[model samples]
Target: MFIFVILGLLVCTEAQGISAGTPVFVLKGEDLLLNVTKAVVLGKFDDFSWKCNKSNIVRFTFNDKGASPHYTGRIEFPENNFSVKLKNLQEADSGVYTAVVMKDSGDETEAKYSVKVQDRASLPLLTVSSVSESSSSCSFTVTCSSQDSHINSTFTCDTRTCSQEGGERSEGIPDTFLQVYQSSGSIICNHSNHVSWTNDTNTIKDVCHQQDDPEGLSVCLVKTCVFSVGLIIMVSAVITVHLMEKLNKNK
Candidate 1:
């Protein structure tokens, strides 16, 4: 049951970063048996720091059980020689880990390992709204949000319809889905309303898709009818002249 237990209170959420050293990770309550004598953190030196203290660890803020929790963790090196086990994990308990190693000559090497908990994929709330109405289509925008203050994620937008998304947000308003077409659950049915690039548009117009096309098509109908009537008149005049010539010849 010998394990290196790093306390869970240290989440990296400030301007000061970890010292230029190695990082390591171990479960809070998990027991591990090491076949090798040592382990250390490995990866890029810039994004994380190594060690088990405030100067050497990175913090991740997450939600836990009914409350919130913080993860102050570091990466440990040389995992192949040792085995690790975890007891309990919370939202504040993500295992994105790396390690840094310093040799006698002062040159550094990095080891990397990713600690991912499979059970927690908290889907944020997705909100869709109609913005404006255009001639042909409608657009809806979607936004995802989480209650935790520390987790800011970049969002990617996509849908089966022809609607598009623009301006990816990482700080706030992670993503938005534009409601363009009037589908089963849509609030409106106008192309302009459905195809806005932002989520804050307050316009709620529902121009009919079929009505717009018909108005444009009416111009073509007028030309077609005129041509048809002209052809009929020409045929009628020619037939009348021929009938008169035949009757006069017979008389």
Candidate 2:
């Protein structure tokens, strides 16, 4: 029973080690530092190796360190620690990396990391689809987009404050998203991924005031036309009254 229990524990430990890898995200063309989570003692271990997708990339003995030829100029292995600095990461370089240590007694230890490389998100586009005005508030619909993703949302603003209405609608792209939200009296459209983000913005007050300009000009023109017509009618009535009084006096 004691031997069986020890074997079961070892199996469980190995399973946990493989499944509980740390997750790291880096942008394409950037560098990353993969740190070893397990403590290392160079004197206690006979060999150390770092593997990617089960293929060895670096190996270390007590006195020397070497890397595979494919990664010779792209990786830096420091002597003071077991950390590896990967330079100019590409999307193809994303994979599970494992650090394996072999003790002199033939026992093995491992630390695992899962790395992802992503591109920076594109700039978001924002446009007003429609606008309506009332005595108390102004309401508008806006569309925000980036690459293949888009979101549509509505905003209502009064003289002092603004709020979103009917929530938001969105279509997403893989590994990226579009979001519309309000901040500091401005509506912001943001496009984002794990690596980077970009945004576009417009002020609520400015949009509402622009919509008001045309309506204001129309109102001014109507008032001026009414005043001019009334003045012409009054002048014609006075001329007819004067001509009738003169004809009656002459008769």
Candidate 3:
């Protein structure tokens, strides 16, 4: 079996050349899989080796296991598998990864990957605009925007509740969401991406304050008009009476 495995590894190395694929992005402190399982294989490969930036990472020998001291505690590989799992990743871990496989028949294949470790999303910014309010209710528009341009959403709120209106979101990427609530004439905006969050609050009391009823104001105005008209009529009647009295005395 040892002789056959060595023969297979030699043949595979001669037949296969290095190939690269699209780059992959992973969040820091997240798990990453260096995948190499897509190639067509005649049978199960016995010898597997993984590398980082062209430096040896780990290898499964027929009789023993070997791993680089740098990745001693942070890597895992299943028996006879070419793929590897890296756990608790860090920013410094981003680099080129390569996987090599050798079959028992001396045929080999290679797979390469470029990795990028990204930081957690930053605190989002919530902006409020187009605010219109009345004595009984308030209406406003809000937008939750992120500096990364990966997240952007619009929302609308009233005294009762707030709801999502429209927005843009990234595909195949983690999403950020927004929520709004009203309390005591204030609107609170919350922006969250599961890992981080931020908030913006605004008060509508200046624009939407408790107000007297419209019917009450109309009634008061009507009462004043009626009183003024009645007083004018009474004064005119008294003047006419005095003028008639003077004319009679003069005659």
Candidate 4:
């Protein structure tokens, strides 16, 4: 009997820990609705209350209801259910919220939620750092940046398709991520979190063609210099040979 009781207590503690760790993500200035999964019958329960970080935010009895002064105008309890709606969530409001129920039969039930409020992710920026082109293919290096994070990735593209040479690159914040990848003919930089996402895109053809003009001009200049040097050398050699023949004839 003693062993069975100890096992039962351990199981109950584990279950409670799992429930208390339920994560809820919300955007800043957004409203969050927290619901109790278990049924709450008014007549069977003596009282119920909702607490945040161990501080009571709302309390309800069979006939009476009250809310904490700190949450006076920002909370709502709907008549249709035992759900609490929190409005205008801010970073300061992020905490663990628990709903507790006390029954007349000396029983208690509780549900916990861990809430995190975050701002929307900023827009991502994509820039090409260097590009190389050949007759059949083009390759380039690009950097993707968002906020304080950045990633560098290389891509190769042909006439028909584009592929990433070193796969995708990514950086992560607490709950946010920045990534660079290829899709279709474009390279995309994405910044995202559980609440919001943004991206920037550029085409492979456009980036490669932009670099080709300067490279082509440099190649043309080199070819012109080589041809001019060759012509000058040939003319000098012919003049020297003609002079030598004339001098020999005079002698």
Best by lDDT: 4
Overall local distance difference test of candidate 3 = 0.63
Per-residue lDDT tens digits for candidate 2, residues 212-234, read 44334445668899999999999
Alpha-carbon error at 59 in model 1, in Å?
25
Relative to the true structure, how large is the alpha-carbon lDDT of every model? 0.35, 0.81, 0.63, 0.82
Ranked by lDDT, the better of candidates 3 and 4 is: 4
lDDT-best of 1 and 3: 3
lDDT tens digits, residues 1-251, model 4?
99999999999999887767689999999998878877887774478888899788888888888899999999997656577898899989999998877675764656788899999999989999778888767888988988788888888766566677653546567888888887766788889998999899997768765333433444666889999999999999999999999999999
Worst 10 residues of 3 by lDDT: 207-216
Task: Name every residue pair that clashes in candidate 3.
Answer: 8-106, 11-106, 12-106, 12-107, 12-108
- Tell me the TM-score of each prediction against the true structure: 0.28, 0.69, 0.44, 0.71
Better of 1 and 4 by lDDT: 4
Clashes of each: 46, 0, 5, 0
The reply for model 2, stretches above 4 Å from the true place, is: 1-20, 42-45, 103-109, 166-171, 210-251
lDDT of candidate model 2 versus the reference: 0.81
When summed lDDT is taken over every stretch of 10 residues in candidate 2, the lowest stretch is 210-219
TM-score of 1: 0.28
Across 1-251, the per-residue lDDT of candidate 1 in tens digits comes to 12322222233322123333222333333422212235543333322233222223432112111111222232232344322322355324444433334443463424333333223223344444453435444444544443431221122212222334442333422222222222332322111111122222221222223232323554567889999999999999999999999999999
Model 4 lDDT, full chain set: 0.82
Worst 10 residues of 4 by lDDT: 209-218
